[model samples]
Target: MIREFDRWAYDNRLRAWRAEWKLIVAFVMLAVVMMGGWREQWLVLIGMAYWIVARARVPFSVYGKAMLAASVFLGLSLLTLVVSVSVPFQITFIDSQLQPAAKLAVRSLAAWSCLFFLLITTPAPDLIAVLRRMRLPAALVELCFLMYRFIFLLEQAAAELMLALRARSGGTHWRHGGMLMYQLWMKTWQSYEAFSRSLAARGGVASAGHTHQREKAHVPLVDVAAGIIMALLLGWAWRKG
Candidate 1:
């Protein structure tokens, strides 16, 4: 999933557009979501969905799967928020929690949709570049990069290990399944070590006595300018509200 996310990010139609505007559009809509009610949130949500699916030309399956992955957490959170009691075999939903939970669910989904659009369209390295251009702290930027790379690396390792197990026809065997976990742990450590070495060789981290160069992309004008303006207006209204 992480690899697919990175793949789409690098290969999406919006990949070449100026990362600045993408961030602007995403953050502005996020502002709208942060302050806007259900109506405003809905607008942002649907608009972002369309931009990602229709305008950006992302495959519907990819988008759905990505959102569905995020939805698992959101669902669990909403479940906990709505369910007041789980002990004594009394898993009861509290009536009083329904409205608040619904509101939270909407807000959370809106926020995730907005952010997901950004993630899908902009590659992680580009985002890190933008953060550096914004003059954010080196430590924070480097940490974010490492965390992002680490997730991708872990996913890659797990996928490879699972594939190996499956190829050997032991993927479903109980003994092999248990060993898979151990293999994955060892693979993760090895992948991390390899990643560290490669990153050091590339001088990926600025703190490692290496000068990290920043390559800026031209923020080309996009057709979404009008949409961005509209979103900013909505953000203004949200401020008043």
Candidate 2:
């Protein structure tokens, strides 16, 4: 389901004009604004959401799921900020600490939304291409590409394994779940080893010349100009703050 949205994002009309570097710069600028104050952070979050949904045409359901996952993690971490243990060893709610907790939550939400917008609008391969253009280490880019590919492969393998187990056992028990997890890890490692051997047989890692093709997509100058403007504004705001 997530991959479907990713594919859509990659093939979207915007991909032809949107530059990966511009998106990265915009995310950074929004992140700086998020750090300024909760009100500004919330506004940034809303604006990012709007751009993603309205301009990018990403489905709200897809965006909501991604936000929910990040929210869960942020909520868990904020609990530590809001709850305290004193010398008496009793956990107490700290009223004053709520302000910091709220600030952190809003900032985190804004940051996550910025990243999620990037992920949904840009494909991993395009991002790797941008890194190569930036002269990032070739080995590091290849490593990132392989890791991204393997993540999807592993997820598909796990889903198939779980479905087969459920079909045979009528549902998974705690013991069965543990055993299934063990099998999944073993299978993943086995696949990785086989893949490594195959790569070695092909004369190890291929050179960038043989692997990645240069991107031909036209990057919009307007977007780049807009990003520069936003960055300048963010810098001025940071200096004032």
Over 4 Å off, model 2? 84-91, 208-241
Query: Cα miss at 99, model 1 (Å)?
Result: 1.5
Best by TM-score: 2
Q: Please report, in order, the local distance difference test score of every candidate based on alpha carbons.
A: 0.79, 0.73
For model 2, residues 57-111, the per-residue Cα lDDT tens digits are 7778877888898999999999998898889889999999998888788888888
Lowest summed lDDT over 10 consecutive residues: which window, candidate 1? 207-216
What local lDDT does model 1 show for residue 8? Answer: 91
In model 1, how large is the Cα lDDT of residue 59? Answer: 96
Model 1 lDDT tens row, 5-70: 888987787776778778988998888788778878877778888889877889999999977877
Per-model TM values vs. the true structure: 0.79, 0.81
lDDT of 1 at 128: 81
List candidate 1 segments past 4 Å from native.
167-169, 173-179, 193-225, 232-241
